[model samples]
Target: MTEQGDTHVKRKMPKGVRKGGTRFPRQTLGDSLAWAKKLVAKTHLGPQPEGVVLSGVVGNSNSVGRVRLSTLKQFGLMEGDSKGYIASDLAKRIEAAPTEERSALYRAAVLAPPVFKALFDTFHGDEVTHAKLKQRAAELKVHPEETGKCADVYVTSMVTAGLATLDGDKIAHLSAIDMGTPPPSPLITEQGDTDEPKVADDDGEGPEDETQPEAPNPKRAIFNVNVTLDSSLDTEKLERQLRLLKKFGAI
Candidate 1:
């Protein structure tokens, strides 16, 4: 008889609901794209011009213009150098793609950035909350307040890109994100008996020496950490504390 073991995963709850009322540097990728499109259309432009020209059009009063422009560049839909911003070939392809292909294109854009990619890979099959993501930013030494803002920005960007879904404070990675890797096919091949290859003549060879160099051992160090918690801590609180300990490399 064979027995199968079930695996249980621990999912962390994120804090704070993501409402449209919440302010961000860039509201969403869709909004930013719309802004860019409008700017181009109003100017009778056949293609996006350099960043400097666009900046001039934004005028001196709009400080948020630069941030929105940066967001556009981050999505890989637009690119810039010293020469300025222009429509990337990939961006053009995405724009021209059929409606059905647009979701994949959006996912591609979301995964283009390292930070967002890391977040998705880390929590792909696991449930995570916005608060946990913010805590992760804190663990990376990001400012507490900015962590919240950045979390919001990431969610907005990914959701707008169609690579993720956000409900309340929970973020779930959507299967729609096209990472460009295809799924493996499940087919089995049957092998029949085959003739063995004749070995070449060798001077009484036993087996090739397959030795690997030993790795050096480093000195081990240990430190103690102390924390206080309520006498009757619940599962959620206990998990959060344990996570904190793990963040400090204590466990």
Candidate 2:
């Protein structure tokens, strides 16, 4: 058994690792969108041969070109295999949208990448840092050297998607979090109507239960916790996990 804070894995790092632990895009979501727009304009969103697709975008199927294609695929903006390529429906929607009306579209693309969603969920309420992001990326099995660029792309994408507000080393402030859903309609309608009859004429029924309960139910057992973590720990995830625990009534 390993000692406390021991992070050693049982096996060596995998061979032929192509990129960082967590998969990250080669370019920002903004850049992906811009490129997708241009490519679709040239191809008119139809399926195209590899050579045509490459020429339309990066002008070659070389390493840089392949990375750009992979990045767009990661963002769910383009779709193709070795045989052919085309812009996705979501990409077409964004292309059709006016510049000012594309915020929600961009947010949808931002969350399309699994890494983007996972990172956002982890650091949503915390003060995010570049070092924190890079560390977290490395922990996810990304190549150590690639984590820095991964962090840069993630931050820029989040900013473009309206999911984050970046300021210097502080990456995201979570200014706007739209998980591609409209606000839940009020449980009681605008006319103050409800489907279920009240179990009591009382007030749980009060403002405390209105949105979501802030405190644990009295019937649930509770214990206090104190933790000590090293720099290797992704401390921001602690908050996200705690919220999940409370949200699921496991507190």
Candidate 3:
């Protein structure tokens, strides 16, 4: 039962927990791609130890190093446990992915982290501002101090993902419609000439002199999509969502 701004957090703030700030900085995707490329090049030399890789590629084994590693992991660019760090599937793909697909890949990675995932899912089809998101973090019972930071992380990540845009003090969710998929093209069939039977004018005695060909029937592609409307989503948002679906080949 607390408030962060216009939004009211209906839950208590969690206590005594630290670690894991934002999933990625604004340029995290680009940095990850660059890092992955370097790592790939290094792998050609030999199987280097994790410490050597982290230290050599990044800076010292302190704040900067830790941040880089954490950000990479959040985007699924790197994978490792107690053993150490290694390139993840996403990392490899990113290295090989085309320039256009890079943004999508980056977004995918950013959303992979739990913090970003929860935030995106909770706000899907909803119009929320930065303050509201902070309030939401508070309602989720995150630490009071972490609320603003969490909100910032969410906003930055969303902006990078093209899911949200800044509007004055508020961060508005991009209309899903603008990003939604286009309607599927109708199937077309080319008609070919066919022989037709003729009837005798007299009592089925012989075939008629002139015969008429039957018209061809082309099958049209029918889309079966169930769309649930949300008051929070406007025409623009709906269009964005559709465009996104189209881009992802969901439609």
Candidate 4:
């Protein structure tokens, strides 16, 4: 008994190996097959080639193109023939898959309070109000890029559910609000008639009241003068002086 116990004793693992521990392996082909089946069922692309079908369904394919195509092929859900990778017969076995339940991860990405606020506040028209989103993300200490990614995911999911649409790149058009028809004409006040005042009324005088006033003329005055000079006065000089005085208005 003692010898068997000693033989069964376990040794301490090396630090590196201990640190690594038992890591979960990547999903197998069967797991990926199940995932592919779910994707096809959700998207409802019939028996077409996977590549062409996926190209139409997914958004911003440049980012996820290779991974998406390879993943579908890695599983048994699709087979690559002479034409291209075509969805397998197993795709038809899946009924329209139920709408995916929102996990905590999906909720955090889409329906979180902050995300809802950002969507409500930033959605002015087709384009997001980037300034408002940036400010909100800064206050929350969340990276602006991550906030934008969350917004994009929410928009994409909503669009897939037919709640919204992508008008163009980075632009989403939401369902319109239902407002009733407008009234015919606006209300206005009518203007009363206006009359001009007579000249006498404006001057504070009655038309019938009159008083006589007299006009006066004044008489014009005439003056005569005589001048005496010495006999020794020079006639030419006097005449010249008189002419000069008349010119200067002294006469």
| Model 1 lDDT, residue 194, Cα | 42
> Per-residue alpha-carbon lDDT of model 4 for 31-148, expressed as tens digits?
3434555556544544445455456433224535444444445323455542445555443343233445322222222222343434533452445444444455545555533455
Residues 180-242, candidate 2, lDDT per residue (tens digit)?
Answer: 444323354334565754444555455445677576798978777554535565778777777
Model 3 per-residue lDDT tens digits across residues 95-149? 7888787767767876786766667667665677778888777776666767877
Between 1 and 2, whose lDDT is larger? Answer: 2
**Which parts of model 2 have CA positions greater than 4 angstroms off?**
1-17, 175-251
The global C-alpha lDDT for each of the candidates, from Candidate 1 onward, is 0.60, 0.75, 0.64, 0.42
Off by over 4 Å in 3: 1-34, 44-48, 175-251
lDDT (0-100) at residue 235 of candidate 1? Answer: 88
Candidate 2, poorest ten consecutive residues by summed lDDT: 175-184
Instruction: Tell me the deviation in Å of residue 146 in model 4.
Output: 2.4
Candidate 2 — which pairs collide? Answer: 20-142, 20-143, 21-140, 21-141, 21-142
Per-candidate TM vs. native?
A: 0.52, 0.61, 0.54, 0.23
What is the lDDT, from 0 to 100, of the residue 167 in candidate 4? Answer: 56
Candidate 3 global CA lDDT score = 0.64
Candidate 4 regions with alpha-carbon error over 4 angstroms: 1-114, 121-126, 129-136, 139-141, 173-251
lDDT of 2 at 97: 92
RMSD for all candidates, in order, please. Answer: 30.0, 24.4, 25.7, 30.9
Ten-residue stretch with the least lDDT total in model 1: 15-24
TM-score head-to-head 1 vs 3, winner: 3
